[model samples]
Target: MTRNNYAPYITISREEWAKRSDDPMLHLLNDFETLQGLNEPLTMEEITQIYVPLSRLLNLYVSGAQRLHAATNSFLGSQFLKVPFIIGIAGSVAVGKSTTARVLQRLLSAWPNHPKVDLVTTDGFLYPNKVLEQKGIMNRKGFPESYDIRRLIQFLANVKSAKERVSAPVYSHLEYDILPNELKWIESPDIVIVEGVNVLQVRPRQQQKEPTIFVSDFFDFSIFVDAEMEDLQQWYIDRFKSLRQTAFRNPESYFHRYAHLSDKESEVIATNIWNEINRPNLELNILPTRFRASLILEKGGHHFVQSLKLRRI
Candidate 1:
């Protein structure tokens, strides 16, 4: 495929990017299996070839941000607290973003200068089932309107301002809802990763006049995991099948009923969900923000990152 010459990003083959890094940090490979998401393949070779260099690049950005912070403090002649460097990871569901975020958290934290890297997913910010039902948007669960946007912005603002303690609502995949009175507390971290499908999305202008902020406003760097539409649809269906055998089998799981369906029946339901819900969200909401990312990880058919795109500064 020919490069889009007018694009703001510099596209490079994975091999070309891998040439810049020689240190694989192989000791970290042991954690890969645990961190990887279902149906996501993350071999040590892939980590060394792709993520090693990516980690180095992130470290550079973190260092530069810290330097700029210190310089700004000096210029103002005021002692300002150091805020965490925030990275936003965005992509469609079942595109391996969770694995990417977890891998980055592990790799970035390995750096001695930034030992306290914390990861949080935007799933926590999604509105509860009751709230969605009240709004009559239960079918649009992953859509932008299904989120508590104002609260998400406030949470990021607190993180960017270096708040002593910031808390986020906890979401449970098994329960498929927000857990009441459960919160994830984040202390002062050197870096914070906010991962979700809609992290790169810009709010619709019709929603509010003169909106003050967006979820991405606080991101120092952002990444979009990209793949062909067909690949994503297939992955989503495959993931559903896998979950039916695993999490969906749990008596308390919200999707427990799905486990009882025949293989063909499950496939039909999964395909319908993908075509009606997830596919439209990807086309209308998520993919539009792909170019807005600082970097894009373009995946091939086997879910391997085939290329990298870094937005020109």
Candidate 2:
């Protein structure tokens, strides 16, 4: 069967993309042990074949953006503050987006022109557990509504405006809640990467007419990780099991109870969570925004990126 055409996006196989360069930077996979996600085995081959080219492409965009800024400043006869180039990465839960963000952060920072790079997740913008409980949306924690949309928008606005010493609330994965009085300071960075499931979501209707701003509006480029739903479900379950063996085993872990369960019992719980919560969010909220991405990394089984779809200039 022939694959469907993704118009306006040039799709290329992994092998073809690999041939673009043979630079040593492309084969820097020694850090894979730290960058790989739970239950996700990212190989050096994949990095050289897939992510290296992606980093180079982003470098070009960053360079172009810098040149444009310089030209605009010259035309206006004013030296405006340099705004950071922001990249947004969106995907379903357990789709290895965090790993992708981390890898890109490392790669982008290594570039001489943009040595100062930072990464922040929308998880930090999520409503506190107390707030979610008060709103009766605790179970829908990763949904769009579960975030403090106004604060998130403001945070991005500050960053894009070149505001100094901007800080965001910090969230603890182990406690599964926002930490009071804790902040992640974001100084002026050459590049900032924002990763989340809902980064590509459209602005809410109430603000649609009023200077319309979205989290994505601040993004100079965006990426969406893609995979078959069945594959994603399996990956989610696998990650859950791996966490149970590690992080979830901690007594303070929000999911500590699952750590002691038998393999079959844990599998049942993971499956139910995926089917009841994650799958619905992906179908209704996340997957719908995939077409909005500047690039789509289509992964096959075993977390291997098989093809890439890049929007045509």
Candidate 3:
């Protein structure tokens, strides 16, 4: 996603992209906190350069979709369920996709009922740890196979159809597993932001196989957050170390074993985990899906997005 496109995008510099927003109320975002997530240094400046214009663009898209849906219903002399505008945001581990989702959810929700915004992460749809252990894929947790693809597809379908009450499985980072009998209930919202590493992925089948549906198939727009391989590795290690002192220190946390480790030991373990699991998943699975996204946010040093590549077609 990072500059790895096929000449189909209109590359915009960070300065120029920031200029796209002429809102007099642009100063409101200066105090809004998008600088969230572990080890993610998202300054207010980054928001103005990236998300402000992006959110403005999304507002227009949502408005246009509403108008088009109303026109269709008027022309047919009947009412149709309003389909929600779904935005899928994808990225590698520790790439700050969650922060992006939260920022957009907050910004979009400010308009009240004009567009009720909801945020959901595909992590909730990942199979339980027990299920993964049974499938012998516990080590491949973030890979595509770790997910309950069918259930994720059904959830997205229900959301798009504006189902009265749709619910998704709840995942617990503390437990590192899907919570038993717990769910995240989602009512019909005007816009839904689905964020996860697997959002933009596409799996090609054997030549004789029948065509099938993909999670991205339901997305009206998709974004892929991209960075160099080394940067991602470092970020993952940093986050892991930070979590050890924080979340992993909780006795109920799944990673409690690493809480007491020295900084050197923590770094070593984190590096090993990245090498054995995360790196392979990124190189083999995640990176290949980058070009499939409608927009690509490419970051350089310091985790700041250097430019944006928006698909022209």
Candidate 4:
């Protein structure tokens, strides 16, 4: 197919734009100053200029999903019960994927038709660091093997199947591990947002026997937060420093020792950590998954998404 033929078919009519202009969800996009963890929040003008279109775009996708369900129900017989629509958000570390997930969750939840929306991050699916250490894979924490793929797959399966109650392990940032016996529970919702660095990563089917059930397999829609490599490097460094000062200062924090470093020392540590750990994980495990997302949000150094590219259905 030619490039044009392969492009995403985004249907944004004037009527839709008019409706979105007055959408209440567009209001939530205003109160937040900047993407979360940024030094400052975005201005109202910036929010309007950037996210108004994005909110409308997401609304269109959600509406389309409902129509698709109706069509499927017609084929399967009218006795069908609707299941939650799951959206996956994936990107490299510090590219603002968390912020994107939160924005979409807030906006999607505001929809009167789908107010029961919920969000779950895949960080909770990672194997505890102790487990990774036992496997001698502590240095590969964010790599695909570091995650409990089976547990993650089962969790998504349950969510997609409309199970009465679903639970996910909780990962502790301060402790830098998955908290034992801590879980987040969810009831059926109109929509669910699953966010992570490798949510869109693809793996080969096992022995070509059964369909692969990688995390992306359960998504009805997916988003990738994208930015220039240099910009992401800087953003990672900035967030790392902020965390070192704040979260790392906690006596029980896994990274507490780094909190007392001098500014110059901290910068060096941040740069090394980014280059050796975060950058490689992004390149080897996360960046390759961008093409698999339903939409790609490209950001500028200012942290505002400058452009959005949606995949062809």
Candidate 5:
């Protein structure tokens, strides 16, 4: 059965909210510390306070998946039962899904068994800006309809089918578009993290109406990053400001026009874009998929995940 077609099932949990400390999982995360980009890497307090616990929890999920795979293999008596564990990470734009995916990919790969992890982002499937402009969907960039959903689904299907080589388009944030003819290839990986604003979103129509395949259908696990709308808006504006000073200043950047704006002007433009475009897409398409994820990482104003709501077993 396809992942999405399965009935809603919960992972067996050892406790309501399991906490971990000083697990071997931390050793696998050595490279992940560099990715975090925090100054004074490997501070004793940081390890005890954060990575140790998160990695431990992830280790549990990985262990559980291995057991399931073993069981399925025994039942089928097939040697071809192996496949990369597929994960879906979804959230509104600027809600820090990228960071979460990066961290998870690095930490998860630290395990001795699954040393190869790959991350594929849905932004790669977004229609080129020129196409969106021609289609009058420039304002609907993050909406479900703005993506090449069929191709995205096919890509996931290819990966899940264990294709020897799979290629995907690449997106450029500075250009704010999908670069034509640019692609990233995956020969094989132990794990694949597919992250995007709508990674878990189903097509708008019901199955009986059109029977479409969603990109989310291939996930073994899914995560939704959520925060208060107000907090999200603030975060979006903050990120936009940072981008303006960095990416937008690049001569080849599509958003170079914003580089000349005054700070106040930039803030105004950012807020307007968020309200008229991003917020609407999040409300109409993305946020609605929260219930579809295996876990919800709810963040606070500080951009830290304050609570995790895992599906009840």
Candidate 6:
């Protein structure tokens, strides 16, 4: 795989970016009460200091995209396309991309201009367990090949092409499988957040001929949530231990077998899984795509975003 140069980005410290108040929208973090103390327990200061600015930035992008779409329509003399500004968020397992996405969803929706913001995770795009088993890639679940890329592309295409409604499969974390009977429907949204481990990935040149389309091709903006490999492993193990007593206790859960595991046993198992599956996937597929992001959020020891690098316009 070819590496991308980071020369396009300008690094900004948490303290510095937090002080930016050129936009009036940056002061609206006080209304975002629902996002406080999520599963990761984001601090109030973090919300004000980090994500407020990010929400404003995304709003600007969404507004610009809306204007461009309208201009194109005027030039073509037709109300043709209704493209939702698509935002892609990528990261390794347990790197808090979901938290960033959920926060952004809440914050962005608060803006009156883009009240209809929807978030779709790529986990829902993963092939069903039965299908993965048939393909002999069940062990490779969460890797890029485990996903139904063509279907995902079609779903995005439908959403971007002003389809009245489009549906995507839903994945159950407790069941560790795609719910065969369930689907999440997306209607007309002003902005869409596509969050996943593989959203930014590109097939290696050696793997096949360069495709005419990629999942990232649909994105107007993208973010990569980054942390050290060791930190990610620790976070994964911690979450596993927490889930052992909660989600794993459900008899219907595929991970129910881990319900009885002691903290030590859970730690050992999670660490092993990290080393075997998640680590390799991060190194080979996920991490390599980091520079492809429009912005990179670099997190510290406790999952706090310490700084960010934004691609210069």
| TM-score of every prediction relative to native | 0.96, 0.95, 0.93, 0.89, 0.86, 0.91
Off by more than 4 A, model 6: 1-6, 21-39, 204-211
In candidate 2 the C-alpha lDDT for residue 1 amounts to 94
Cα displacement (angstroms), candidate 3, residue 267, comes to: 1.1
Residue 209 of model 6, lDDT score: 57
Ranking by TM-score: 1, 2, 3, 6, 4, 5
Best by TM-score: 1
In the range 111-159, model 4's lDDT, one tens digit per residue, is 6667888889999999998899999999888888899988999999998
Poorest lDDT segment (10 consecutive residues) of candidate 2: 21-30
Task: Residues 1-313, candidate 1: write the lDDT tens digits.
Answer: 8986676889899989988664746686686789889999888878888888899899999999889989999999999999999999999999999999998998998876789998999888999999999999999999999999889999999998999899999999999999989999999999999999999888565757685678888999999999999999999999999999999999999999999888899899999999999999999999999999999999998999999999999
lDDT (10s digit) by residue, model 6, range 80-150: 85778899999999988888898899779888678998999999999999999999999899998999999
Candidate RMSDs in Å, in order, are 2.7, 3.0, 3.5, 3.5, 5.4, 3.6
For residues 1-313, what per-residue lDDT tens digits would candidate 5 score against the true structure?
A: 6576554545423232335465555665555556642211234344444545555666677778878888888888876746777889999988878777877777777766678889999989999988899999898888888898878988988888988789999998877889897999987887899999988877556546766677778998888888999988988888788778888899999899998888899899999999999999889888889989988877777776656666755
Candidate with better lDDT, 1 vs 2: 1
What is candidate 2's lDDT per residue for 1-313, written digit by digit as tens? 9998757899999889888744667545576779988898877777778878888889999999999999999999999998999999999999999989988998788776888999999998999999999999998989999998889989999999999879988889999999988999999899999999999999476736566678899999999999999999999988888999999999999999889888898889999999999999999999999999999999998798999999998
Clashes of 6: 0
Clashing pairs in 4: 8-312, 33-41, 33-42, 34-41, 34-42
Per model, state how many residue pairs clash. Answer: 0, 0, 0, 5, 0, 0
Q: After superposition, how far is residue 36 of candidate 5 from its true place, in Å?
A: 4.8
lDDT of 3 by residue, 26-117 (tens): 56566565438988987777776788788887787788888899999999999999988999999899888988888778677655444588
Better of 3 and 5 by lDDT: 3
Ranking by lDDT: 1, 2, 6, 3, 4, 5
Colliding residue pairs in candidate 1: none
In candidate 4, stretches whose alpha carbon ends up further than 4 angstroms from where it belongs are: 1-23, 29-35, 38-40, 74-76, 205-210
Model 5 clashing residue pairs (backbone): none
How does model 1 score by TM-score? 0.96
